[model samples]
Target: MAAPTAWIVAAAPLAAALSALAAAFVTGFDQRSAMPPDLAARFYGFFLDRYPLFAFAIPYGVARLLAVALAPGRSGALRRVIGAALGLGLLLGLSLHPTFGGMVLRAGFGTGSGAFLNGTPMAAAYAFGAAAAAGLFGSALGLGAALIGRPGTPRPGSRRRRAGRAILHALAGFLALWFAAALIGLAHDAGFGPWPRRPLDARDAAIAAGLLTAGALPHLLLVAARLRRATRAA
Candidate 1:
């Protein structure tokens, strides 16, 4: 029982690392246009099309691996710190976007420069401060989760644990398949650049969906773990 469970636990991280590596490849393959607005459009397009979804999965996948890797040794303080840090990082990212430059939907060169450049020095300072705070917070959350969750070790299994593992493994498999399909779609090159098309290509849409699925994996894993534990204890 221990050996097999251990293998599953080990596999979780392997999966996450592989997924992260995949994300890097996807980002690299989808080159952004050179112009600032075009770049911004590509950046925003990545996020809008499906990148945000994929982004969340990454954190989720990494978190799951971390949970297994850090378990037993982890403490309560660490969990709190991690929660805090994630919360803060989220906050900082949001706050910085506005002050760094007023949120202009960047189009193309000379497309909307005025909107893009509408931040005062004071605004910049505030934005920077917010970013710093967020970083500190995210750091705290990571530390706290590490300490408290005792992340690496799998808890003793009962019927509930088994069921939970089954669900998670299923989820992981699904995500992996989804990612593979997305990669295929991306490879098709529905349209490399951000020039608007009358109708977005199917391959591009699939890629977007795949990216989102990747991003959401982390949160899904967290929830599954918690629920599994709860069911086991009950």
Candidate 2:
């Protein structure tokens, strides 16, 4: 059976954004907890972090989807331009958000009213920045993949294959790091871990690592799949 068109188009970006936000929120809430910890707070933090990624991915993914929907022999120049512009605009807009702008000003100049925001807002700002960075980077990568896998692109036997393999290998390494961090966090929570030597620190690291890994999985899978398809096409 054929897959739904919308799902096919949105799957990668949606997965990427959701996974990253999930990890960030889980970590943020875990760190902020006191006493018994608040599930509601955690959920709130998750949604807060999720909004930027979702917002950013929608336009970016839609642009890419439109590009892919074009005729196979058609030049992708316009699509590429649109994708880059949209990705950049989205990141720039997020960077300009008051909470994020304040955070950056505080970090870079150390001369802003960090008092402008606190707690979830502050966390969301950070999440927005991180998501933006990832989105931009992923967009660039998507462009590269599209170029390399273009309908009539040339394929240099070992070199092209080697490059593709290397990219996949790097992704695997990242996944391993994230998995290990998650395990470490789990162990610490269970009262049997080392390295971090502090419960809170371990928990934070684990949550972040696990979430990042999860977020990256979709991109890695998409790239790998593209490479396979390109190889076959060649």
Candidate 3:
């Protein structure tokens, strides 16, 4: 069931790109109705701009490429591509939800642009927070590998187990912060948080929270399952 060709890699990424673009278009259409047409267009354009993509592309591309590259069989690549497309779409859609200090990671957070992730502690908190959420987006590609097979040769030794468990816990905690970031957006949408920040309407925050949360469920469950399995094997 091994993939012997290189084109599969290109195909998977091409499909995911198309899906992500399509998702952006769909969300942009919704934004038109959600806000004034001009603002919606500005945000939509920003969503796809090179700057934001620049922030996310390097790490995400490396992770996604690895997932497709490692997929076992012909069908395994296809199955993972299906998940890749969906994951890419969900990540793009979630990025549209405005929050604070999220930087270009989720542009339109504290300011209109990314502004990198340095400077103030608030900005760094958001940078780390968004990276955490993006961590799930990056790593979740591995979950698609599961469709190809089950866990193999449990890495032997307590050290490996501890490290794996630690990584999972960190990702889980980061994802929780991602959710907390969403809540912060929700609060602002409800007219409570920092003033003059980029605004996400109540509907915007609610919808984004629900959709991103649903998207995160698989990553969360994957972590829980791994933890449980590791515990049992110990």
Q: Indicate which candidate wins on TM-score.
A: 3
lDDT of 3 by residue, 1-234 (tens): 212222343234433433443444345433235676655444554333322222223333334434443643345555555656665444444443452112234433433123444454665555554554455444444343333332222435788776886577656645643553334333333433221123333454344434434433444454345434543553
Worst 10 residues of 1 by lDDT: 101-110
lDDT of 1 by residue, 24-60 (tens): 4454533342447744553444333421222333344
What overall lDDT, based on C-alpha atoms, would model 2 receive against the true structure?
Answer: 0.39
TM-score of 2: 0.28
lDDT of model 2 at position 112: 16
Sorted on TM-score, highest at the top, how do the candidates line up? 3, 2, 1
TM-scores for the candidates? 0.27, 0.28, 0.32
Which stretches of model 3 miss by more than 4 angstroms? 1-44, 47-50, 53-70, 73-85, 95-104, 107-126, 129-133, 139-234
lDDT (CA) per prediction: 0.40, 0.39, 0.41
Report the C-alpha displacement of residue 185, candidate 3, in angstroms: 20
The lDDT, on a scale of 0 to 1, for candidate 1 is: 0.40
Candidate 1: give its CA RMSD in angstroms.
Answer: 15.3
